[model samples]
Target: MTTESIAGATVSTQANVYFDGKCVSHSLTLADGTKKSVGVVLPSTLTFNTGAAEVMECVAGGCEYKLAGSDAWQTSGPGDKFSIPANSSFDIRVDQAYHYICHFA
Candidate 1:
């Protein structure tokens, strides 16, 4: 791999793309891809394998999650972190505007 400098800070960018509906995107291959979001709405469905994620909120909003086959959704709001288990996927729903971060490992 190669390294570069940006704005007097050493940072890395592997040419990841931010989805049209999402605010941030990252390509971390250590376990799984990592994605960080801010002021954007994401898809309701997500699947992760061999990894998990930590969700953080800057401007908190209502967030919901559910298993693929389940009809009920687990909900959260402001200052909450949702754990996405490996080998299992989840669906997320948001109510109101928010700024948040998602780190996958």
Candidate 2:
């Protein structure tokens, strides 16, 4: 199931914009100190490096991703998720706005 809402989270008002506004997100900290980010990627292709393991949970729309050192491209849609290892990277292509939650592990 997809996560619809988060309660008792400390949200940073400022948005983290990347790729010249192709992607934007707001940082969030749960009561237990779990880190997360709610974001949307506009129609574009982008590469992202991970500092920690991440679970990309799709909340709306979709995106196709190719992990570093892999030739296969995978699709992720609403309610779907994909994992990226720490210190890894992934390339994402979006034809439409892709909404997601980045869950740090």
Candidate 3:
């Protein structure tokens, strides 16, 4: 899989980015190939502010997930998943980052 920066408006002066994943080449010749299959895995402790949220799909492994408040969390293992809409935050452990794999669907 491949990751690319989305470009458009430039409200900010700078940005910091990083990528990590595994991928395979697309079949067929480049001249005739339509697209390739790829996936992404973001395994890390992510902190969102008061008005921030993210949507992620679990492709593999087990991850411990928790919301900003309350005292309960769910495990995203294999097909198990969740979505963090806008204006919410979640805290994940470092170990949770490992064993996450995404693929072209």
How much RMSD separates candidate 1 from the native structure? 8.2
Error of 1 at 103 (Å): 3.2
Candidate 3: stretches off by over 4 Å: 1-46, 49-53, 96-105
Per-candidate TM equals: 0.48, 0.97, 0.44
Model 1 Cα displacement at 5 (Å)?
A: 22
Which is the leading candidate under TM-score? Answer: 2
**Model 2: lowest-lDDT 10 consecutive positions:** 1-10
Which pairs in model 3 have colliding backbones?
1-23, 38-104, 39-102, 39-103, 43-97
lDDT per residue, candidate 3, 1-105, as tens digits?
Answer: 312322232222232233333221122112333222223335565553324344444545556778777467677765555666567766654453433322212
TM-score of the candidate numbered 2?
Answer: 0.97
* Superposition error at 30 for model 1 (Å): 14
Pick by TM-score: 2 or 3, better one: 2
Question: Per-residue lDDT of 1-105 in model 1, one digit per residue for the tens?
Answer: 111111232224643344444444333333233344334345434332324545444345556666656788876665666665555666666555434545443
**lDDT scores of the candidates, listed in order:** 0.47, 0.96, 0.43
